[model samples]
Target: MLVRQCKSNFLGWIVPLLLLSITVHTAALAQCSPGAIICETFGTGTRGQLPQGQTNFSYRAIPCPNDGEYNVMDTVASSCHGDAWHRVTEDHTAGDVRGNMFVVNASYQPSEFFSQKAEGLCPGVTYEFSMWVMNINKVLQPGPCDEFSLRNPIIAMRIEQTDGTLIREVVQPAVPRTTTPVWVQLTMQFAIQTNVNDVVVKLINKGLGGCGNDLAIDDIGFRPVHPTLTIQFPNSTATETTVCADTRLTLSVGAATGYPNPVYSWQQSQDNVNWTAVPGSGQATYTINPVRAGRTYYRLRNAQPINANAVGRSQCSAESNVLIVNGRPDAPFSIGDDLALCEGTSQVLRAPEPLPAGTTIQWSDQSTNRQLTVDAPGNYWLETNLNGCTYRDTINVAIQNCHLEDIYVPDAFSPNSDTVNDKLVVMHPGTFTAYSFRVYDRWGSVLFVSKQADTHWDGTFQGQPCLQGVYAWTVDYSVLNGQNQERHFARSGRVLLVR
Candidate 1:
């Protein structure tokens, strides 16, 4: 038995090579490579049914139909394609196209075809279409030998524009005649001619029928030869930095090259792992108004690529670095609403202690010190600036007056032992610090004197009752002014002494 494989170069020439029987047998177990944008393995759905996202080509042979025009089959039948058909499973290169494989036969005409439409392809972008195929022949009644003469079959793969114009076409090496079928892997690389956004990929089995046009293909894949997509911050420092609360931050994406026109979206995350899209952030630049504190992570996500083959989505997306922001502290101090001071005294107003570092204190008088002294009263305030934020508090102050006329003294007292009118006293409206009262007789001699404010004068001289007559009295006292300063007060008045 002879086995051959073919490869096409950039110029579209088929280069054939020979393989030993042992090498051909070992090739049945080959697996599909990774990185395909679309891989139709036909692993889903029941046998004899069409796979999802695919349909049979309109062209079909009318004469010798044995089953549905297009069907998926399992590797349970011995005479279906070849003994090696079961080895060609979906991802595995060997083992009957993994679970189920696509099948088409040319029972009436010399060929049969199946096609599917592919959308969102980049114009003039090179893509590789790959699949595995095997020839099927009828088995005799007593054994797995062919009932008719053995024949080789050819498989052609083509990409056509929506209008059915061919863009590129390549035929796989013919499947050689053998008692047991052998699976061959085929790949064709092509680019769309014009700006075609949609194209049809068709796989056709071109071979003579009688009993030899049956073909089983599996593990189809379509992908770009080179996939490119990238996202980065224009300013490297913006990746990991800090910001102030309510500050607006603008983040822009770095220039991306090689990828087709790509769509962008901005996202934010607190943990840097789970991300959510920021509304209205679908442009190349995004802005943030951080009204709160704590750390936030941001990244630019490549949402859709002009070339569908490019990779940039959720886990595979390009992300920016992290940002940490801080908010302003609360008002630090409480200045009482009202403050009082004497007319001639000064009072010092102090700011709250243990102030935060980098704090700036300003007074209503434009003083930068943390303490201010005021004598004249009106309104005073203090403003503190910390971490780029400001807070203020105000106080009202009033001045008080102290006068001598505010004190009153009684003019007369009787020493007759009656409870009423038995003592001489001085009365004042305000608080006094010191007070003294003195009484004199008609002969101009001092009779009684008291040093305490609450003490009173009784009508007596040297332990003898003085005659009841007019007596002279003098009183002195001191009171605190508005500024807490003391002022002296004195007065003299005549009083009548009665028995």
Candidate 2:
């Protein structure tokens, strides 16, 4: 009874055949961007012939190509795009458009393969491959024994040289038997090694078959990959071209995609004609230590070429705009040696002449002017910076007190208003803080008094010309000493007033 039931179940369909007529709504085709070297949709050309640039096995039965026997399918149930798809088959769909499926019967053959040759490929160029595949196993009734069960086929996409040597392989798990056909997408990316010009893309079916080994492929693509490299800092396009001298500058390189270990070499030039490589400056980032002064130029070169293709040659090198490093102005500015000033006196400190354009001068007191008026005695300094270097100069200033010995007082004068020797006056070389002059008569009575050191006695008593005789006059004054200390002084003398 068990044997009878198994046999009956094996002959009956698992799913109704009516559903096979239902069409599946697949997503839109994914195509490579512009500039692709090769993009094959298999949508053009006659149904029975291979794609425009593709070929099939030229040999006979048994031990056929590993790509297996293939054809174009237009059937709604198997096609991936608008009415067409590339199908691999074992027998039923041979030389006909009715067969829109790829089948591998490993029970009769061990290896079956399909291949397409892509030409004009660049040497040492990166490319991407994309395609869609679907497993087309029909649901069958239960079998009496598991010996006739459907076997999933292992599918692999390979990139090969002209001699059939493998360059890269992308393998997919065996397609499981499904009630409804389902499309699977696969993508592979690789870089062609140096000296390689052309490559063949092969799809191989490696599976033992007694059951389902059907597959459908569509929308294949091949295109060159473009990687971007941009200079980030010390932007060459900026308006300002000057940088500080003696400063450490950083050059940065940025990438959008591509090389995993990109190599960089930085070079500098004075005249923009002859460039020299900077030692130890090979990386994504390079720092210039103590940058030189004057106008200079910089450029970056990719030591490790990302792609050998001529298409990317321009991106491999970048030239920066002119860089002008402003150096510090000359040092040792002459503001004179140590200087001395009397109390209440000021001296002007002037910066050296012939200042460079864009040079800035700053005094120790934070004054940016070219000259500073300093009254207090102390150490005064000036700093000048140009292009990024700083130069400094300093001078010591001494404040001293006034000395009484430097003062002269005349004791005799004629009040005849002759303009000369008309009055008794006190004169001093330095500034005076306080002064007083007084005259006394022979009777010891005060006759004239004055408080200003510059004021003079007219040899008068109460606005009246005094008689020409011996008169006693006294003067008092105070002055700052060498230590800025105030000292008082007094002098009394007898003067003869003449009319």
Candidate 3:
């Protein structure tokens, strides 16, 4: 979308997009800004005819032609010139399907092929003129002539005043042939001197007529490329561009811009791909509605008001980098997870509070209460809103059973087939760090031993059942304390094992 102005509030700060009409500096040729003030994409589709030109060459309606002739076609078969020319499968412009390129077969003598008068340029503005060119001659030939001995295409582009006074001329070197179509873009910059609002662009052939000097050209573009504009927040050295929500702040280029009188366009987007212009006149300042609470992308475009082709049909504009704004409330809080509760006990869960006035809260259980009664272990969440910012937070809860005693060992057990107390096992409610349970005989011989909490003895020695009498048992273990440090403990007792 296109607009001349836009405004957004950054945490109480209002950011306004402004269109500045600055003074023009000396028209010295220099650096480039990526905006299209004049672009001839050659447009879509195959013309299947010759483009209007100022050349002495013939206009061929066919895709392939002899010397001193040219054609505008999307594709030229490699077999068109008896398999001598490289196959042109696509246009020089990316994503331009079935787009035509200007194909030329060199004349016997050098001559001018293109000449046009460009007007509406802002005085003192420097512009970059560029076009994509490709050599259509195959590197390897089917003829007796080889690449080293064959001629190449050399095109020259010149810029001059309307009366034909020379400004600058760039003559391209002979473009070399390739196995496949290889497009190269030629670029040159020229400045519009004071009071100069028009200029003439011309293209001339400088190569000798030969079997290998065939070429194609497309996507010509020209635009103001000097005194680049950079938009940044105050404290330009700091990378922080964020402003507080709901604030009004004016953004400006600050320094004097050297481009005559340029028009500005402001635009905003949810996603950077699609843009909507900010609405306003071509003035220095305009207002945009208060920014909504989310991330909003913005940009400022600079262009000349005078009518160039791109400006008359679409406006010659250069857009700025995207500016992102976010609105947020600094209220942050948290709840505990993996909580421990004693047997037959319950705990209260509180929504993050000590909240500001006019704040609202809702628990996951649909409870509006500030504190919730939780009896079982599970998950809980809270949705909160204060001022104009909203937030949702969640926490998980798992039951951790704890007892006054750390470990519990069975006193006695029988190895009978019946599912009675047939195994001696250790039981504990607290988490274990290390443990060893063992049973010893009267002679101090190790009779049974285990390391795992779930492992047990079957009142037997190897494969034989133990004698029906009392057996000495001992347990050495360690369990984690409140501070998560291990506490060592030992216990020894005599248990009667009935086998």
Best by TM-score: 3
Of candidate 2, the 10-residue stretch with the lowest lDDT total is 10-19
Q: Candidate 1 vs candidate 2: which has greater TM-score?
A: 1
Rank ordering of all candidates by lDDT, starting from the highest: 3, 1, 2
Q: What's the TM for model 3?
A: 0.48
Across residues 221-258, which tens digit of lDDT does each residue of candidate 3 receive? Answer: 55555454444444453322454344444444434342
TM-score of candidate 1 to 2 decimals: 0.42
TM-score of each candidate? 0.42, 0.36, 0.48
Please provide, for model 2 over 103-222, each residue's C-alpha lDDT reduced to its tens digit, 9 standing for 90 to 100.
Answer: 233333435356665554444445555545665555555353325655566766666777988777655666655555555555555665666656666666666544445455554444
Alpha-carbon local distance difference test for all models:
0.58, 0.56, 0.63
Please, what are the lDDT tens digits per residue for candidate 1 over residues 1-499? 0011111011111111111111133255433445555555656435344434344433232322342254554543543444322232342244432366656555444443556666655544555656666654433233323345454467666667768887766666676544555666667666544467676766566655544556676666555544343334446644455545444667675554333465666777787778777887767777775434567767665523543333334222333434443344534676665876766988889888877788888999999886899898799999887776666788988876535347666767787887998877677766778877888877678898888877777788788888888998887777786567888878887898878
User: Which is better, 1 or 2, measured by lDDT?
Assistant: 1
Error of 3 at 319 (Å): 5.1
Best by lDDT: 3
